[model samples]
Target: MKALFDTIKIYPKLIITFLIVLTPLFTLSLVMNKYGSASVKSEITNSMLSKVHFYNSTLENEFGRTIAIMREFARYDDLDLLSNRTEIMNYYEQRGAIRNLQKELSVIKNSSTYIQEASVHIPSIDRTISDDNFGTIQQDEFDALNVLTNHFESPFIYWQDRLFISLPYPIKSNRQPPDFVVDIEISIPLLKNALLQFTNHTAGNTMLVHFEDGWRIGGDEPEGFLQAINSVIQADNADNAELHSATVDGQKYLIAFEKSKTLGTTLIMYERESTVLGPLDRYTVWFWMISILTLIVIMIVSYSVYRLIHRPLRTLVRAFRKVEHGNLSVAFDYRGRDEFQYLYTQFNAMVQRLQQMIQEVYEQKFRVQHAELKQLQSQINPHFLYNSLFILYRLAKKSRDENQIRFSKYLSDYFQFITRNSSDTVTLAEEVQHAKNYVEIQKMRFASQIEVAFGELPASYVDLTVPRLIIQPLLENAYKYGLEEKETGAKLTVQFAEDQADLLIRVEDNGELADEELIANLRRKLDVQDAGLETTGILNVHRRLQLQFGAEYGLVIAQGESGGFSVTIRLPRTTSM
Candidate 1:
């Protein structure tokens, strides 16, 4: 069975495939069939009990009217005098009294709908009369059925074509003697008429059968019903059996039964195996068809999905495999415009970039080694400058030349600033001091030709971090390319201020602004691997800032307000300062 089901997993578009999937559904049908039979039986029992209640009510109503007549008759002024009367005929011959009492009795008897008979049996006169004589019961049964009204139920009741229910009550006098006995009878057909009110025939025929033994109410099955009832008792199952069935020859009869615990009795109801399960059979057929269609649909869908998506991705895998095996010339065969296709195009571009970067590395290996040598060469740079300043100091002291001393001190401070080699990044305050020292050093060479003005230092922004030598290079570029060209007092201003959501540091000079073509070419060179130290510094600062604070905070270069172009360094409001 497991192997058969596994075959369904492989090829699901066949009848056996549905047969496996639909087995649970068939089991559910059998379960529902059982439930339906039990449900119908429960309803049948309720129907019969309900009918029995209606019959009891009808009898009460019929007998109630006869009682009313007797009550009215007892209220007469001469009614209590009946037991003490001397003679029977004399009591009737009591002038106009008998005639008047009989007339009142006649009106009371004829006024009721359910009352078939209303009569008084006078023990003193040994006589009995009724509105009508429907039938009579056997003497023994009548004697057992006649009891005082105080009892809840009587021991006997007669079953005939006419009245199926009867009750007797006494009418006593006040002389420690009895006045009469009142008898009432209710017709059976009248009660059965009320039983027909329940329109649900699937429940079964409802009837009230009050035998001499006891009463049996609820659902009437045709036959083989007793055996099912015997099963209920034999099992001693307190909870009702949901459904049971019996086969008489080739025909099957479904049965459902429930017993009322209070009445200490059983109720049996049966419906046909076909009638109760009609809807279930139809639904099962429909579900079988749907299961077949579902199996076919899953197989078709799985195939279609594998072709559209997995096949295209498989092509990409082959291209990567070829690249892995050192086939550098192999390219992706991309056909669609999706993420996978975009990756294909990007992979081709990346391969070209990788080849170019490899070639440049081979060419620049000498220059890279030379820069490392240069970096190591500058380690004891301050010591050499300090010895030179020391020699100049001794010479100036011996000769008493104050101007020489001042110049040597300035030189010492300048070399110390250059050779500190503290870190690659420093605060804005440190950068400003470095810039001032550079300006002082240049003054000795290009004396009074260049003017440098420092912007107001904001205490809040002075602690801002910048790459070391970034500002100094820009200042050098300004003097070399901009302010150096001016004849009189070339001016340079380094400004810092908060600009809306950004912090700006503007370096401007009274010099020349490069043309658009130069600016565009410089931008391209700054983007290249073989770019010089100047472009590399700006690109490194910009890329680091972009990596740290994102693309919005980086270098901005443009033509200045007055003369030479400016580089405005932009910073974000992420750090506290």
Candidate 2:
């Protein structure tokens, strides 16, 4: 078994695995396609039947309500009086009765959404008054309506291409016109609109058909199609709602119909079978195509396994071996438009990026070490120590024990921090404390000449990490160069402020001798690209900050608004170093 498995390589294994997986899937799809298509057809039929029945019920309710309203209006005493001209003997009496009848008709017309106009016809007065028109209707039009009233047995009648519901329905067996008729013209447009809502999203047609009168309405299809549908309904003679399939003009259709009991009309909704089953038919075709193509693909993949997979894999393994041996220049070249080509391209790019990153890392390490050495060399100044010790000595000699002890402690902390050389960065709190210590020592020496104001450090920024000894040098420069000229009221301010982008630590001295030329010279020195030229002082701080963060976050030196030299150390607003 082991030998057989070992002898069968990846090419045959892949083909065997794909066949095992796909054969059952193909069979399953065929079975599902048969059942799924049937399910879809059944669902469409039920949906269409449900929609048609709903719309039919809606129309029946509307027509029934309108008929009820007309019947009620027909029984009004004013209509009875107006029906008999002899009862209203005078012109004023007749006019008043007709006016009252018109008012009632207006109210009834406005009450029902389906009532386009409510009218009253009086045979004795030889006039028809409607809510829409106060004048009499045409005599010939009235004669036509009268004829329909006697002809149609249903309450709903079609006369002169208009639909109406007339009161005093179920005409007498004598075929004689009644004393007065209350005719409510149905709003065909509104009815059509209601019917259209059912088929708005579907490729279906809706029609309202009156079989007895051969009246068809509310459809946009051709008259021949509608006539064909009418013939089917007539031949079936099914009064109840039903869903059926029929063939019309060489095309099959799914027809859903419901009969309106009140109006004796049928609402028929029909759609082409293909329209409903198009997606399923397309899926069936696609399934067969995919099955055949999958077989072809199995053969194609077996052929390509050697050319696409085997060769590229060998090349990749060789390239990896070269890289393992420190040969980073190895690259894989594949020109075919396939996944193997993408893999080879990415491999080449990764190798190139690895080489580039190695060089960057080396250069960055060297720069950091060089900057740290300069910081160490510049911070360990003998002159500053001499001044601090000398100040301590004078204080001890004067028998000021408290001042001596305080100065000694500040001096100890300051020198310990500068000499430790443990880390390249410290918290803002530590740096600010160190700067404060230097300020205190300097204040002790130059108490009479200088007045220093050190702003409180914000608690939020206390933990921010920054380069070591970045702030102290600025204070040193302010005291040594800025406060040297002023004797009285020589204010030196150390403030911390922050904006959206950077944290600013400013050192300003009210030196009257400082001018634009000095500020310009200092700015020029900061902009110098030659890193080896200036390794200490403000230049060192600026370069170190730029290297740590980015070039945008370093230093800004300008003349103080009042009269002094101000140097601001701008560091990025970040939580970590």
lDDT (0 to 1) per candidate? 0.56, 0.79
* Among all candidates shown, the one with the greatest lDDT: 2
Query: How high is the lDDT of residue 478 in model 2?
Result: 79
Model 2 CA lDDT for position 382: 72
Q: Write the per-residue lDDT of candidate 2 for residues 394-454, one digit (tens) a residue.
A: 8878966677888888888888888767677789899899999988888788877998889
What is candidate 2's CA lDDT for residue 28?
A: 89
Clashes counted in candidate 2 amount to 0
Enumerate residue pairs that collide in model 2.
Answer: none
Worst 10 residues of 2 by lDDT: 144-153
Please provide, for model 1 over 215-264, each residue's C-alpha lDDT reduced to its tens digit, 9 standing for 90 to 100: 44334444355444465445657544345566544556554444433223
Clashes counted in candidate 1 amount to: 0
